[model samples]
Target: MDPVRNPYSPGAGRQPAALVGRDAPRSSWRVALERIERGRSSQPFVLYGLRGVGKTVLLSNFRRAAAERGWITAQVEAGAGKSLRESLGETLHAPLADLARPSAGRRLLIALRTALSFKASYDANGIWNFGLEAASAPGGGADTGVLETDLRKLVHDLAAAAEEEGVGLAILIDEAQDLAEEELVAICAIAHAAAQDEWRVLFAFAGLPSLPRVLAEAKSYAERFLYERIEELHGDAASEALTDPAASENVRWEPSAVKLIVEESAGYPYFLQQFGQDTWNAALEAAITYDDARVGAAAGRATLDNGFFRARWDRATPSEKNYLRAMADDGDAGSSSGTIAARLGRKPASFGPLRANLIAKGLVYAPEHGIVAFTVPGMAGFIARQPSTD
Candidate 1:
């Protein structure tokens, strides 16, 4: 087997060779696009899940699908050292530029002017030239220095322009749980308005499992948004995810080998791909066998431990690592805040900053009131394997 022919991809947000078990969400997004193209509104999609569950991959798929349909699509990630206003302004520029022309529709011209204002709102020294007389267009009030007011004006005008072109607008945000509270509230408000007014725009957000709760807290209307919880593949879907890619390379996996990798990876897409790649490299024959799977799984685990899990583990301070160690006793199911504090011989109130810091670093999340869990799967086991210094 040639390592160069390996079809598996294992990295953050990397698209898999065979994306399986996501038909429901993908179909729903297609329907949403069609509905918007037909002057109908669709509920925003909120995808929440643990890290490495393929939320980013699915969101990227939605972006590609919308772009294929000629929609005005801008996909951005929050918490990347840029404000929402700045990130959205920068991402929307290229698409908006593509739509600019001398014979552009009146509404499109207006949208271009509005976009200029939005860009100016964040970057006073920078500007965009759409090669049209947009300065004289009838739209340009989006630079009001208010998030809700400015974003609403920009999106509304853009949606109108999209409708004029017989398409739609799409705005997708990943790592949404990292957005500022005010920014999240503003987005929810604008999305609510778009739905009520039947604007030709669609929104999708992806983040940690706490994303839905975060949205609800931002705006009550977010309660009605369509929330899809992405999890590991199961049953036959999981098997197909591993087999389909290998089949494409004209390789076969013995039933015992497939079962070994599937069970060991626990159906996680990232883990499956890692093990699949390793197994492909380990197999000397055209058919992967159980022995090869054992070696590959071990190699894959070592790779994850050194790179994936260790990276996050090293980001924690010693005090935070102690806190994480206390939580590891509960495995991946999460730990009670009170119990973690009791284990650390400290009051729960005193450990609030530690818990908050972990959450801020994206290593953990509060799944429910007073219960925090690792945002990454199998984190507890990784933590447990570390040498103890306390």
Candidate 2:
């Protein structure tokens, strides 16, 4: 065990040393992959949940497993500070290159040539070939439209080749909501094309709470075509993530502590991982046995004060902030859209967009019609600290 490690990482995008709370989901996720491999569930899948919910890490692990299973995998994160079309093109091309057979190098070059036109530039080899051009504007004779077409064609071809050669293709997109509506549609269209061609190209995406709705809005057939949900681990499953892995590492978690952590996390993998890490860190720090009190103390107030939590805080406009303050003072975690609007001194109708925005940011979760509450546990404590009268 690394004594200095602070396992409770709460950053915008942090990767784990080893995924501690993911063992349970693997079985069901494997079923999904097997279905994709057998060409049973070919539609894109959207995995979504509140921020810091470990959806991203699950997707990464699933992608690695898919690759190891002989599936060609392409990973694209939608919010990595790039245009969706550009990122999608690059993502599609990488897997085509990766899974290309040695004999298919010519086909890959031809596809690239057909997609991009380069200037005549000579390298040290003195092989006067066309220099690679911009993907969007391949200099010579290639059209931007052709790049799009060639990309789709290339993926379909790759999938077909993989199938013939006894492999599969998997495309995993995280933070998928950041993708432009048009690009999402285009990628789905490509997936549809692959399906028509009997090519096994599967997509798995993870994003904020609104992701499924976004996809549904983009394509009416999205709901019918995809398996979408926040990845969940049940009691036994959650126990496996904590106890089984620890046992392998020669570390042990008291059953009571594991049960408490599972209950607190609500089976959310990221929370489970965070709590386990914090408990471990806490135990190490105090040089004491890993007891509930010590672990809980180590987690302290910052357990949920994560990047996701801060993001919700940062999303509040001055008026929204005032509304939140009012709610906090009233001992309310959230308000009805109309009530929030009224408190903010705005017309109720104008609150629709703001409410949607808030929901998408994962600060609030809708429990029933017209009712919302903080998604993060114990957020009301932080809200109480804010000056409500401001």
Clashing pairs in 1: none
Residue range with the least summed lDDT across 10 consecutive positions in model 2: 118-127
The global C-alpha lDDT for each of the candidates, from Candidate 1 onward, is 0.95, 0.60
Per-candidate clash tally: 0, 0
What are the C-alpha RMSDs, in order, of all predicted structures?
A: 0.9, 5.8
Which one wins on TM-score? 1
Q: How much RMSD separates candidate 2 from the native structure?
A: 5.8
Q: Which candidate gets the maximum lDDT versus the true structure?
A: 1
Instruction: Give the TM-score comparing model 1 with the true structure, all chains together.
Output: 0.99
User: What's the distance in Å from true for residue 1, model 2?
Assistant: 7.9
Model 1 RMSD, rounded to 1 decimal: 0.9
**Candidate 2 — which pairs collide?**
none
